[model samples]
Target: MIDPTLPLIDLHRHLDGSVRLETILDLGRQHNLPLPAMDLEGMRPYVQVTDPRPGVMAFITKFKWMVGSLVNYDACQRVAYENVEDARQEGIDYLELRFSPGFMAEPHSLDLQGVVEAVVDGVKKGTLDAGIDVNLIGILSRTYGPLAAQQELNALLHCRENITALDLAGDEANYPGELFVEHFQRARDASWQITVHAGEAAGPESVWQAIR
Candidate 1:
């Protein structure tokens, strides 16, 4: 086994996925958010993979509850800050945290740009405090369709300094990367780095489409 004390690098950690469970409970309580359950064990199945899931959709559902906790700018910032802190605690030396600002803002109808800024601010503070290097990636959900993806891309472009890249995430088996080719092209035209989530939930064709 790798030594627990050794420093590591994490390139694909998701900000939403990395949120500490305790933090989610705290946010829910502070915001008076209507959660399915009030306790950690009670909320586990809703926010985590506790059962044997056969498909990607089942895996993706775990995010919905956690995403609901990010109801404000402060909530977003706290999640980002804690994400980095958790990585630091795990001995992660360099981390690239990715998240969909649109997803984080959707539950509360928060501004996408504000969400991005808050996450960036939190990451800056966390990295400083933890002595780790970190970068952020903005995600565009494939399931949200073309218009929403374009809007997300626009938001990401506007916060280029805070965001290091654009990532395509969501149901790859059903919503292929080809569906957002134009949007990805636009992101590339704006000199933004691009990464696509493919082949994990789909076959090689999904990867080919993302690359194409």
Candidate 2:
């Protein structure tokens, strides 16, 4: 399992979902947010997956404290920057880090557009510090419903230049691709690459719908 000549590229990664636990505890304390645990070991079970999860939703629950720590724009930036550093430490030569501005903002009620800008800025700085090539992808979290997805899409579009692609994630079974056809169309119109999470919790029909 040794291939030194080949390049290491990670095409699918969620920046919002890859937040550091230490940072979460740090930010949680700084903002006086009510975290389930105060120390690393105590907080691990809440913010991490120690046991097997039943489904996507159960697995997604681990993200609560991860995002809860994002209490401000600065916190968002720090998370993004750390993601890049982590990727570099893992020997990744290039990465595409995706994020949902709406999801990241909802915990703290931060401005959507501001979150995008801060993430872009943080990635830019991280690229320099880590000496690795990185690309940004904007995600529309379908768990928030169509109207709310529109607002999420708008925030992604606000920083369209900085983002290399658009992805549809969250509750694949409940929110099918049909609901986001228009949203991806707009993303395509913007000349961004399209990616989606389909058929994971749903049926083959979801994959066919994504293709259509």
Candidate 3:
């Protein structure tokens, strides 16, 4: 067995995707959120990857339910805190957690800045409690189109102190990185580090566009 005491690093954990199922159920009850299922087993297939599908859409569906649970600032903070706590338990010494504020706030009508601040606050508390180091990355979803992408990037810039980097995610096959070159350039000019999710659902050309 692997040593539990050994240090580990996780570089690409998505905050929305990493939320715990128990927490989701709790949030659903506390906020009276309308979830598809009330119990864990009934909810598992909706929020967790249980099927053997070999496509990105199948994986992306899990996040739809998970994001619904983030109905308030407290919920966002709780998920961020638990994400770090979970990482610590798994022997993760350093982690870079990423999330799209627009995506998290869309269903609940929460402000993007509020979501970012809550996650940052939770990361601060979680890192101190877990004795681990963590960094936050704000993601821009290419599927949201250019206008939404610009707004999300603007929010990231406003919270640049709390956010360590900016990431591009979602539907790499349908939306190419060249569509947001200006926004990425703006982020680079602001001195923020950039990470693009490419070549996973799409081909090498997508990755090439991201790099360009």
* Top candidate (lDDT): 2
lDDT at 183, model 3: 89
Pick out the ten consecutive residues of candidate 1 with the lowest summed lDDT.
Answer: 155-164
Residues 1-212 of candidate 3 have per-residue lDDT tens digits of 98877778999899999888899899999889888999989989898877687788667878987999998999999999999999999888999999998989988899988888898899999999999999888899887888899988887788788887888998787788888889888888888888899898888988888777
Error of 3 at 163 (Å): 1.7
Model 3 clashing residue pairs (backbone): none
Model 1 lDDT at residue 114: 87
Measured with C-alpha atoms, the lDDT of residue 46 in candidate 3 is 90
Judging by lDDT, tell me the better candidate of 1 and 3: 3
lDDT of 1 at 197: 89
lDDT (Cα, tens digit) per residue for candidate 2, span 113-134: 9999999999999999999999
Clashing pairs in 2: none
lDDT of each: 0.86, 0.90, 0.88
The candidate maximizing TM-score is 2
TM-score for every candidate vs. truth? 0.93, 0.97, 0.94
What's the lDDT for candidate 2? 0.90
